[model samples]
Target: MIQYFRFLIISLLFVSCTDETATAEFAKGADVSWLPQMEATGYEFKDEEGNKADVLQLLKDRGMNSVRLRVFVNPSSDPRSGHCSQEETVDLALRAKEMGMDVMINFHYSDSWADPGKQHKPEAWEDLSFKELKEKVYEHTFEVVSAVKAGGVTPKWVQVGNEIPGGMLWPEGSTDNWDQLGQLLNAGYEATKAVDDNIQVIIHVDEGDNNEKFVHFYDNASEQQVKYDIIGLSYYPYWVEKDYTETIDNLAFNLKDMVKRYDKDVMIVEVGGLYDQVENTKNLLEATIKAVRDVPDNRGLGVMYWEPQGEKSWSGYSLSAWQEDGTPSPALDAFKN
Candidate 1:
């Protein structure tokens, strides 16, 4: 009887795949990049008195099953925006996990924002030698991920860097330095693996529909020995001058073609339809939801509307506009497929 019980346990373990494999099925997930704000006191969506809504419940109610969170290596010197600190991120992750949501970690590898136009090096990393910088990257990544895991919320997926086409960590690891870039990313991968081998390492890059640039960027990464599981894309219709239907169609075609060609699963890690009369945010959301549901060959894995509920107005980092009473407009209806 004991032997039979042991066999049953082994079978269960063998059949149950890791979170990475399970999520690869849908490529379906949401990036909850606003946890820092939601946890703050007296914070209301768009500063509306009644906007104290539970975002996680709302997303789950709408059929979202996973959440992605971005971690800045050291965020800004400012105190308020400094909340992506290890303690803050882990706290948010724990809450999400308790609510029965899967999580993904996006490593920006900078103290502040890291993107295509600006991938600045951390202040501390500015003086490090090449070898020292590599070591620091690995150490920092391991510590952050280890803290998240220790906090009882294990992320199934991790992005090495954000929208890094020109490369991240500046000068040394910047675009023209493929050798340095490859070394830096490998360090991040090792850090993630040290936490859990099952975690999927994602190499995220922007410019989804632009076949020429995407292909070129990825081919370069491949040659550099940057090991990763998922290829993440950031698609914004406004940037490409395409309508909602046209954008989704283009995304679907590219996704299917890329998967077939690269033999790698794809995730729209950062995607948003600006609700503020830009890119027809409303129409784009509707189309995106439909696209996700009817994604051809299951390749349209996941689409995360970037910071839909962030502070409104063009003056701040937030997207979207507000009504006189601070009511969030219908731009968010894009998620309601």
Candidate 2:
């Protein structure tokens, strides 16, 4: 009996240690979902030495160890506006992985952008009943995740929806109908796990500083038994039109509260500052990373710049960290050390 108990104890310890090792690595990187379209349209990427190279290599050389790619449902081929379709997303994921970086797959569930302001159900899904809608959600999620995994890299994180503060899929899947919204979210979770049970699922919301928003959504999620493994947040000072210093403390507080209250890991999955304010943006990035690292128990998993490589000149996104002359802003150096 003593020998049998010893064997069992060793087995249990091995299992526990393995789980910890699986998630022990910290992720820091950017989302360059627009790279394919950007390169195709002649946006040259140069490294610090002014030598043109793959943008992923430049990013990896600058303290990034992971990559986040956004996947849209059925996207148009518009070079500037659209084209994050599954094929594009999968190709990017493979490139990042080939560069020895971990991957995070973000699902928008829309043909275009999906945020708090808009969560348009895919045009194909607009007419389906709520029950059918859930099925489509599962089918779509499973197909995409399976394709990504089959492409030689299993994503470490998969966001069910991007910045979904108002709930996803609208009308029926809106926050106004928690029961149906919960079901829709669960469809995503179930389908994701069906593909790879180990991939962590994230329920992302914008406004990391607003503990009230997290409490409200997560509270209802808990009540509805929404199956998710992480709380993903997006913090943008530019959008709020305020200095990050104003809410940095609140963001830190929310990170601490989330881990303890939700009993799950958290990640500042999206964060970026304006390109013009290099110093302020660098300080904000450093402070934001420090806040996540300060979370007790290592529940803070990662920080990803929304689109650091999407330079303003080419992408017209003012918050990018790339210079018009094809170089990264010093702000990205915050990830170092």
Top lDDT hit = 2
Instruction: For candidate 2, write residues 274-310 as lDDT tens digits.
Output: 9989999999999999999899878898899989999
- Top-TM-score candidate index: 2
Across residues 1-337, which tens digit of lDDT does each residue of candidate 1 receive?
A: 9999999998888777654465554533466665465445444443235554676765555556678888876666353344476777788888889878888888887877788988888787889899999999899889888999999988888889999988989889887999899999999999999999998888888867777777888788888978888788888876766665666777666676677767777778877655557447666666665555464565556777665545444224333323334445555544544
Query: Could you list the CA RMSD of all candidates, in the order they appear?
Result: 4.6, 3.5
Which residue runs of candidate 1 sit more than 4 Å off their true CA positions?
1-29, 38-41, 46-51, 77-82, 289-297, 313-337
lDDT of every predicted structure (CA atoms): 0.72, 0.91
Worst 10 residues of 1 by lDDT: 314-323
Candidate 2 structure lDDT: 0.91
TM-score per candidate: 0.83, 0.94
Query: Could you give me the TM-score of model 1 versus the true structure?
Result: 0.83
